[model samples]
Target: MLVAVLATALLVGCSPRSEPAPEVDVTGGAGEEPSLEYTPPLTISEATSEVLWEGTGPELEDSGPVLLDYRLQRADDGSLVEETYSTVPKPFTLTPEVLSADLHEALDGRTVGSRLLLLLPATSDTSSFASVMVVDVRPTRAWGEPVEPREGLPAVTLAEDGEPLIETPQGDPPRSLVVQALLRGDGDQVVEGSTVTVQYTGVRWSDGSMYDSSWVQGGPESFDLGSGVLPGLAEGLLEQTVGSQVMLVIPPESGGAVGGEEDTLVLVVDILATSAPAPDALTEEG
Candidate 1:
């Protein structure tokens, strides 16, 4: 369903018409799914978007990953088409190659946590339909209050673009797992079995050499905390909030071997977004 909508939305060249953009009454607080009130059979001369509410977080200045929660409705009848508010928010890169020109313009210069209303006109293509979209911008990196790390751990610093730089400590790695929050976000808490989107860098405690990185992979990656992950990495992410950055020190027994080495693993993870399992899935698991 979303694929079809995106296909039509990304296409260029809408047939020009005389009708003005409809006045949509969007009613919803921040972090809630919006309720849109607009008359049916809406028409617009061109594709346009309006910022309903602005955000206070970091301003987008580059082509990077953006987390979004949005809803699409048929402009002709306001019929429900698809939405991401009830599930996990989707990720998209902020680039002209990845998004339509109109969408890229609407999202550019906007800060995280903004809500936008977009009016797209029908194209000449027979498969196209006019759409009214409401979008909520979620943070793609950790954005929150900073926290002080405890003493005697590997120090962490940030680059100009927010990537973590790790300096290895001199002593032996801790025998047990260590989970420390560096940036405390206010978003949803990660539960026991949630899927999370994150940007992370993993380094070895022995020589401070990087073993893995999501940032080096071009963008963030999603992980299901319940399976197919290092036991200590998954355990450390639990209870962390969205938009937070955390440091996890995993012992050899918990982190297992990394790159065929049995050394301790040090990971700095930026918790971008998290989606808890649905009730039915949890019931099945139980």
Candidate 2:
């Protein structure tokens, strides 16, 4: 999901591929040293993106979601098309299927604080334009410390990226819900009433069976970490930091959001990103 309101698909005007690639210079733009520039060929048949500055931070992954502050301009008349410089960067998934083939190339091998210039020439299927993107490779989620199992509780394990592997333990289900952090992160803390993007999987501890998963649903989901969600999820996600993976083992009392009645509910949640509370929410509190 795009940050700063709904993901926008606004294109004021389309630039024809008839003209040569216009000269683009990001000199003194957005706190970056204005040293990067690119000029397009008069005629082109392919899409291309080049990194203006490979940020000095850790290298970013070729796959996964990435945040970017972007500025776009039409090549024909050099009119500003769109931008995210004033607001929070947008979250864009990096898979070739989620993004275009050429877009993946631009994000590939880039460092977290990198800057890039993508010049997609005219194509039979798409329009032509120049886009300047400042990539902010945020921290990836990680598995935290393991939670000690209670007597007769189900066993849980996680894959490298925080996917859970469950093995049901034989005994009566615990009477209350359980929430644990499998991994800890160093990002800003998640307080009550925050909004977040999370990757999660839900299952039944009774049979070690799967119920729902955000990963299988094509991507993680973004929502306010408040009453708008299931009781189990709302409570389970509370007070976790961004980039931390948590596990929630729920009983009937704390599992109403997921329709738990007789089954023992288990959830593995990765708190991927968090955003500030809405202005309206702040106003209401004040």
Question: What digit string (tens of lDDT, one per residue) describes model 2 on residues 224-277?
Answer: 766567677787777777667777877777653344356777777877666677
Total colliding residue pairs, candidate 2: 5
Off by more than 4 A, model 2: 1-48, 52-97, 108-115, 119-129, 143-153, 257-262
Q: What is the lDDT of candidate 2?
A: 0.58
Clashing residue pairs found in predicted model 2: 27-34, 28-34, 143-183, 144-182, 144-183
TM-score each candidate: 0.89, 0.66
Reference-based lDDT, residue 284, model 2: 86
Tens-digit lDDT string for candidate 1 (98-216): 66666777888999889988888777852367888899988767887999999889999998778899997569788999999999988889997788888899899999989898777
lDDT of each: 0.82, 0.58
Winner by TM-score: 1
